[model samples]
Target chain A: MVTEKIIKVHAPATVANMVCGFDILGFAVKEPYDEMWIRLTEQPGITIINKDDYQLPAEPEKNVAGAALLAMLEELTQPVGFELTIRKHIKPGSGVGSSAASSAGAVVAANTLLNGVFSKEDLVRFAMNGEKLASGVKHADNIAPCIYGGVTLIRSIHPLDIVALTAPPLFVTIVHPQIEVRTADARSILKKQVYLKDAIKQWGNIAGLVSGLLQSDYALIGRSLEDVLIEPVRSILIPGFNTVKQKSREAGALGGGISGSGPSIFMLSKDEATAIAVEKVMQDEYQQLGLDHHTYVTTIHSSGVEIIKA
Target chain B: MVTEKIIKVHAPATVANMVCGFDILGFAVKEPYDEMWIRLTEQPGITIINKDDYQLPAEPEKNVAGAALLAMLEELTQPVGFELTIRKHIKPGSGVGSSAASSAGAVVAANTLLNGVFSKEDLVRFAMNGEKLASGVKHADNIAPCIYGGVTLIRSIHPLDIVALTAPPLFVTIVHPQIEVRTADARSILKKQVYLKDAIKQWGNIAGLVSGLLQSDYALIGRSLEDVLIEPVRSILIPGFNTVKQKSREAGALGGGISGSGPSIFMLSKDEATAIAVEKVMQDEYQQLGLDHHTYVTTIHSSGVEIIKA
Candidate 1:
């Protein structure tokens, strides 16, 4: 017998950094999410009906949502069929945790349809597996924040220890200049070995960011939220990235950097005015470049992944 | 005519790592410091005056304080003869910012007696020069904290930018296992290049420490306070280093590592009882090692340097 159930989920866009945190930290946003609709079918196969028709993968093993739902089912004792319809709102390869949103939303929808068999943590693990299948690396710094919400720090990758940091009352402004830069190409250009001095400088910034966050010393946070090591190397791949960052800082941003493996830039501010100011600067820069872009001014999210409407 | 004036000053002990802040960030201990005294002479020549005859450099040019003071005098129009008498309390190379104490104290004393020509910042700069003379490198992670009083993060060494971190209420337990490890030898033994994987792990820990300190997440702080890259190479120089760390952890330390370039190990705890517990464990381990050792159980010093009654 086919158990027909419709479940809807929203996965927020995320700024992968608040300055010093590169691949190891991120926070979720309030709008511009990837919504997914999931239902269980009697047919023992996986199929993705790409409602947005964004040339998304339909194969269960290949698609992010499909891969995650299949991974979750693989852990189940009984075989099941799933129909996942992904509505891609967060742009693909925009450095906005796109794959994370799809994976998170799918697993959440699938698990919800199955009467919530797997725990939230189990969902994160399962989503990570799907992420690995999609991105070829199992990094959860971005995914955890998208799924769990709040400012998240990934202490380790092998053991996958994720901690939700105490969220400061803040806003995040993100700009995705519609320039395409493949993640694979972006990863290839970075030098394998860095100077010891650069490494130490990066550590200092990390330390400053941590202390700033804890003390709510916004100025220190702004001062410390600099990426001397990774951003310099990675920003070269994104057009007008340096300008955006400079302009954003001028616009009264605490600080911002290339979001995730960019083509997108993110700005973090203490208030809505600063966030809006950052957004305007980024938008103005993008308009001058004649590149279409998307922007978000968000607060620090304290919640991760949850059922939206079922 | 000779003017004999007494000055009393205190420099705080500092924690090098706020969990993941190893080697890159440190803050001052507010109290329990090493004290020194300086006296001017009209004998028309520099004189040697070591109170305890602790085998430090007796020649004005060779002494750390003397070297720094001489350097400062060289920048001035007037060159004066003086005798430095140090009533040493903070043990040298104990990783409680000892060299920092001497370097900073010397400049403070010299600057004070020189009619207050140099500012506190100028003193810090001069002391760092002394540090460079001693360690063959000019990094102010330790010296700035000792001089400035609170938590200080050395962001850049070349264009030296020091950011003062607002540290929360914290307790510290420092144990100096009497085995002497020369800073020169400790530095010499470190390998030039570490594995990329290990470097990545180290960065994650740094990020964690920064976040842990910022949010005051004690558990996160403890978990992030690890050094897989530099510590392993440096720890080989100190006997029973690993044992003390493991035992201290078991005894409830939030976590700690080698104090500066050590024979000293420092741990942070949330409370006095926990710090005491960790200190006892460290002391017991040193006793078991059959080594004559000393341990200081104290708290995080919010103040850096102070002038006390002579």
Candidate 2:
């Protein structure tokens, strides 16, 4: 039997810590994905073939994609060697789950090459090892959505339960400003103890947001997008975050807030025209601050990692 | 136009603090309702009539139903008088939103008699004044569900927003072990500061529960009903709580925990047969403890505070 030489996969970027659901909910976006190519090797060690504009580590163990593939390799009964090549388009530290894309993509490509031995949930579990390497905390918020696509709820981390929720065809506007905000720093700013009252409100909004997505209620989704806890503290780290959010709402975004931990802001709209309008408002706010930013107008990507070439 | 002399309404009992939702979520049950009769009077002050089995206050201002009526009356432009008669079936301190039935029923009945003057939101706002009289703390968990029916989420207290979620036909098994567990006392036992990790899990469960209800996913609803925070503390107050819950689940209940701030334990099941089976387990547990208990097999009430006779 002849073994397949090469397999390539694409994993879309995900929005983590969606509005009211900090570390609990996430969903995938259409654009800004990372592509990975894996080739079977004779040597019994992993190697990174290319390094892009982002300063990804050349060492396989240190690299995000390499770390994920290494974790997945541990479970295989037979030893396998692969050289992984990653073309990273999703910017690192942009709060759009850049590392997750690489990690999920690599594992997916490798799993396909190895005759698909793992389930999607198993892939997510394996990919989380790399996520832990990238972001210290072994949370599945980004990886779950990046692997499953659509809106996902991380019900319990200890039990590792993830639920894929039904959602409408909603347009997304994301603006990633050219500024670095470390996830650790963004996390450090949050209070360890939140007011119980605030927690109640946050949970209520989370329930509402889930309902809004399932029901395709644009107004309810907008109303439930108010985050009283995490965003208030982290929004200060991003330049002109408030202005962009306000202008996005003014320009007809259903709702929006800081995407993930920092510099990137995202909004959801009901229509393509509103999404385009929301993008202009975000661009205008960032442009006024004389900041270079990349904005993408896209829709919710319901499917996560996919094989592009084999 | 000749105004009707009497308006009577039935307010169904509600289960508040639904598992992981703490102070924000609630849903109504079909049985154990309170009936309120309101008659127009010549005098411009409130009066209470026909309080049975419960030592309700005669003083209109201090009475739960009367207080809610007074709050609603204040919004009336013209001076009007109402004499209220309460037929209370839901017992006080049952942890089944008994007081909320009275308050919500009164406002709903009076609002109907006054020619639909107040909106449902306004009715809830006024009913909360009465809830404060009953529980000392003004919370809308019970009142919102009792007023709006189905499963309701109290998204914001400041803005007083309530979202009614669509739910499938779900049967509920409730066992009230006749013991006094004051709402205030139940609340006092809880730790003021919960671990942030636990709060995150609770909120995630809240989102999942809402999604489960909307999607009518019975297994998901059962899975999401595990409360790691409030129930652990409050369950201690109820005798045979743990055994009842364990037995209920053993008997094929979807899931269950302490209902509200218990002496009452409730379980949700997909079918009436399972609900009935769950009730037997609950009864057997409390019966073995030689405690007086009342058990009901009911379904989710989709409408709340309806006029039985006008």
Candidate 3:
């Protein structure tokens, strides 16, 4: 019998810039995950394989998974190579951290093959390369939660400080309206400057949100889940966004908003029933708009890239 | 002995905007309290007595405490009159919540006499009137902490939401440089608009600060005690502000910034020894600059207005 060095992992999906915590807060979800397998290769270079219909690049540099692996391999003192296979269940451009799952998945699998030598922060650092490849910038909002699991706060990026925050149990309902919102367009549309008053309100909301999560105050959480800056503008890009969100809250969601750059909307509820009910609200709203959409009812993922077969 | 029908309360000083949380976060301190006595009277109007040489106005409309009392009085269905005596230990224009102590003291005292008829939120609403009288704008950063005690986040003003936050054991050191930076001048110097990037950073810090305080993570709190918006502009108004803050950090204080608008600065330390050490640094820095200053070493006051003598 041959002793084969292979690692298979499940990397969860994530929601970034959660409501008032734009560019800072994010959390991993239980469903809509990506599966990846890594094998130690005698071939001194990386090999990429795509099993999904996304028809993603097999070239190491162009691929999200490949790009993330390349960054981690560079940090190793001893040379190592990996053969990567990706099966992405999370649809690309779904506004639910599709790129992050691919990026975080590859690095997490490669790290296991390397005997878990890299820290979660190191893995996040390598994974951000994939985000850069996907979005033309290195952002950890999605990558951090996808790698660290649970709810994560990207306190600072310059030195890379990640604060893993504990939140009360929550059910997440997501609806993707099947609209293409280029990340660049979302970035460009935001005003270069905002009123100081608005900024203060935004931070005040951020503070309240953090406090609510820490204290497990659901009402406070609902009150703080407001975005005065990005949501007002980017929400215009997603049809039925306001209706979906308002109706979801009416259906019993604590509160939620656009996931990442969006076209997808997410709502948080205290129970699975409410989450499912919120999901129905999303499905109905987009259905009435005659827009193609997808919805998921899930919970906050506890662990980031779960190891399957090692 | 006949009942005196008098209420004497001690209102502690507070530090508003506690670094990156401008217009949102604040905390009460134990020392530098204002002693006030509110007497039930049948005069059917308000009477003001000043025990200090600050020469504050005797007119109810012109006084901070009086203004706050007047606001609360309007809400009462039946007519109520009071004779208010104020002996303020917190200096006016020192930026250490001097006006807040007066306002909160009067309101808390009034509420106790009313048998706690109003909630903390109601008292905050009334106290904001004092803030308006003092600074021409109703702000609760100071009033919230001065009334609720410990740390408070004024989540919103229009709707009036106050979230009392629990913080880890900590010491507060304050320095008043005896120079006056008018509230109007301090506020007018701030930019009406801030860069979106900077605003993101500010909110990120606020999130981290709130998380740190709730989680009892001192290092996170220290890291988050940074203000890129208000501090840069307001610190210029306080002589030796930079040196006092920098030297205090070097002496092992966690981190801190301008207490409120300016002139008075506050530092947080893990213990009393460090707080006193930070105080000495404050004193030395101001002394070297040949500026007379006052310093206090205190802790967070868990109860807002302590009834010294009922």
The prediction achieving the highest DockQ against the true structure is: 3
Writing each residue's lDDT as its tens digit, candidate 3 over B1-310 gives 8676789999999999999989999999999999999988987778999999999998999999999999999999999999999998889999989999999999999998889999889898998999999999899999999988999999988788889999999899999998889998899999999999999888889999999999999999999999999999999999898888899999999999999897899999999999999999998888899998999999988888888776
- lDDT tens string, model 3, A1-310? 9798889999999999999998999999999899999898888778998999998889999988888988988988888889989998998988899999999999989888878899999999999999999999899999999998999999999889999999999999999888899877888899999999999889888988989999999899999999999999999999998898889999999999999999789999999999999998988988899999889999998888899999
What TM-score would every model get versus the actual structure? 0.86, 0.96, 0.99
Whole-model lDDT, model 2: 0.88
Top candidate, metric lDDT: 3
Report the lDDT tens digits of candidate 2 across residue range B1-310.
9865788889999999888988888999999898889988889989888568788787878888888888888888889888889999999889899889999998898888877878999999999998899878889999999989999999888898899999989999999989999888988887877666778989988988998899888888988998988888888888888888888888899888877787788899989999999988987887789999999999889998888898
DockQ (Cα-based) per candidate? 0.48, 0.77, 0.91
Give the candidates in order of TM-score, highest first: 3, 2, 1
User: How does candidate 3 fare on TM-score?
Assistant: 0.99
**TM-score, candidate number 1:** 0.86
Q: Ignoring the other chain, what TM-score does chain B have in each prediction?
A: 0.89, 0.97, 0.98
CAPRI category for model 2: medium
Return the top candidate by TM-score: 3
RMSD in angstroms, candidate 3?
Answer: 1.0
Which of the two candidates, 1 or 3, achieves a greater TM-score against the reference? Answer: 3
